[model samples]
Target: MKTRVRSADFLGVVVKYMVLFIAVFVVLFPLYISAINSLKSNSAINNLSPLQAPSHLDWHNYVTAWVGGDLGSAFFNTFFIIILAVLGNVILGTMVAFALTRFDFALKKYIMGAYLLVIFIPTMTVQVAIFGVIKDLGLFDTRFAMILLYLGTNVVQIYIYMQFIRRIPMSLDESAMLDGASYFRIYRSIIFPLLAPATATVAILQTIAIYNDLYSPYLYMPSSNLGVASTALLRFQGPYSDQWNLIMAASLIIAIPVVVIYLILQRYIFAGIVAGSVRE
Candidate 1:
């Protein structure tokens, strides 16, 4: 009976792993095909099946995509936007979270309630209004506008931080206060260090979000040459048609940063989110 049960359990494990492998392959198969095809010469790609290995590697597509996409300037713009946006979220988010969690204020509940309400409201519904404000502020075609827009739209991150902060011990703040530290000092010196894990998670998530963002750049900064990698993919698709290999190459480049980030930080991401979400 024991041998029979063990056999059944082992079979179930094998079945589960097989199903998971199939699911992953199903999702990644197209991306793999694209990557393989991107390395083939145009003629080779036309002749060979996408699943087949490239007969001759054509690295020129990467060069062409980079030059045609004007990816250098776009990459610089994206780097700054992503960095600034992450910085804004971490700093302001920490502060907001600290206040809501550590300090007691009369309007705190009202403010928290407002944030909760606003969280569910879709920003797309206010596109026209947002554009008008952007124009009025004379930031219609500037990277600064995108930065500001990112800042405003990231309140959810602050709320996440706030939830996490509530889990931290109040005694730490009390000890800091007893030692003649100000609120800002306590935050900077004590709390911020401990929140590194959460901040890292937020940075990784926000970086991906801001980097891949295309619509805001398109709508707000259409005349600006500071397009992000995501928007630059459009150049591969002409009015007449699209170049599949070039598009794939450009897309693969655009995807590299996000993939690298996830691979590097994924070890901590879920733990941080869970810890932040359930903080006492």
Candidate 2:
């Protein structure tokens, strides 16, 4: 009976390892292929196996793609927009979540329900209305249009913040109030500082979202100068479609920033998520 139990435990370990390896491969295989293909010439990519590395590295592909795609400007635009959007999202999201959780107000249930309802609404259904509003506000064909659209607090941010904030003891607020601190002062000094974990999680998520969003930039900001990292690839759509090496090089360049960011903050992400999930 003991031998059988040990065998079962060993089998479970082996199965877990196998699943982990498969998941890693599934995530990394495309990145590996892209890195290799980006170094090869267009003709070489056609002749060589997709898995094969380049015999002679050609650095020119990156240069051409960078300059031709106007990726420098695109990256700058993307970075600027992400900074503003994420900052706005974190501030507004935290404040709303704090208000909803810490204070008792009328229609609170209905407000929370409305936020839940927003998560179910398909973005495509109301895009025409959004477009009209953008044009009427004279924000069309501008980077600010993207920023304005992205600045709104979403339910995910609110939920994450609420989960983290709920765990914070109300005694802190009472203590501050007893010291003659105002509600806003307690929120600013006490609540906001303690929400660092949730804030980090929300910032990372919002940053990736705004970075990868091709549709908003493409639709609202049509001007070449205002192009973002995702839309930078669209320049190769018509005539340069056959240039896979340059395309891959461009893709690799665009992918670097977010990858580095995730690597640095990945610990925070996992911790924040776990912290939010289970009651501690």
Candidate 3:
């Protein structure tokens, strides 16, 4: 009986490590190939195995990609858009969440039902209509168009805020009301400040999503001056399509921001998720 238990534990340990190793390889392998290919010339890449490192460091590919793609402006554009999207989503989501969870209203259940309904519908199906609306609004080919699209609060943010707000005690709200504090005052002064963890998690997530979004930036903002990092990569495609080294370097360059962001704030993400999962 003891031997059986020991064997089962050993097997579980082995399986867990195996799965972990495979997951690590799945993520790191492509990044490794991209890094190696980005360092070599087109000729060197064609001749050598992707797993092998370049014989000599070639910094020229990065320089070419940066100049040809106008990555500085693209990065700036992406950064600006992400900041606006994160702020808009967080503020609006927080307010709506506070209203739904705290106050009793006539249309409350219907409003919640609507949010649930929209999440199941895919965004791609509505793009044709969305595009027409943007044109009608005169927001086409501008950063504001992308900002407006992303600015809307989504189901995920609403749920996260609700979860955090639920955990906050109602006693604090009642005490503040006794002092003639308005609902807005109680929310702004007490509730919002206490939601720092949830706010951090939401901001990081929304920032990363907006930063990495290629579709909105590509479709809505077509002007060269408005090109984001993902769209700017298109410049390498028309004439420099054969320049795989430049393409690889450009791809890796654009991915750097989100990677750094995830690494830095990843702790908050886990904390928020775990904390939000439990309710009193």
Best by TM-score: 1
Point out where model 3 deviates above 4 Å. 1-12, 271-280
Give each model a TM-score.
Answer: 0.92, 0.89, 0.89
Tens digits of per-residue lDDT for model 2, 1-280: 9999999999999999999999999999999888898899877888998888989887888998889889999999999999988888888888999999998889999998898777678555677788998899999998889988887534578888888789999999998899999999988999999998778888887788788888878889999999898988776555468778888888899889899999999987777567544532
Q: Give the TM-score of candidate 2.
A: 0.89
Q: Taking the tens digit of each residue's C-alpha lDDT, what string does model 3 give over 192-225?
A: 9988888998887777667767777788899988
In the predicted model 1, the residue pairs found to clash are none
lDDT of 1 by residue, 1-280 (tens): 9999999999999999999999999999988988987888789878887789797789998998888888787898889888888898889889888888887899999988887766677676777789999999999889899899988876767766776677788898998889899999999998899888778788877887788787888888775386777766665466214567787888888888778888888966676667545633
**Of candidates 2 and 1, the better by TM-score:** 1
- Per-residue error at 17 for model 3, in Å? 2.6
Off by over 4 Å in 2: 1-19, 271-280
Rank candidates by lDDT, best first: 2, 3, 1
Better of 2 and 3 by TM-score: 3
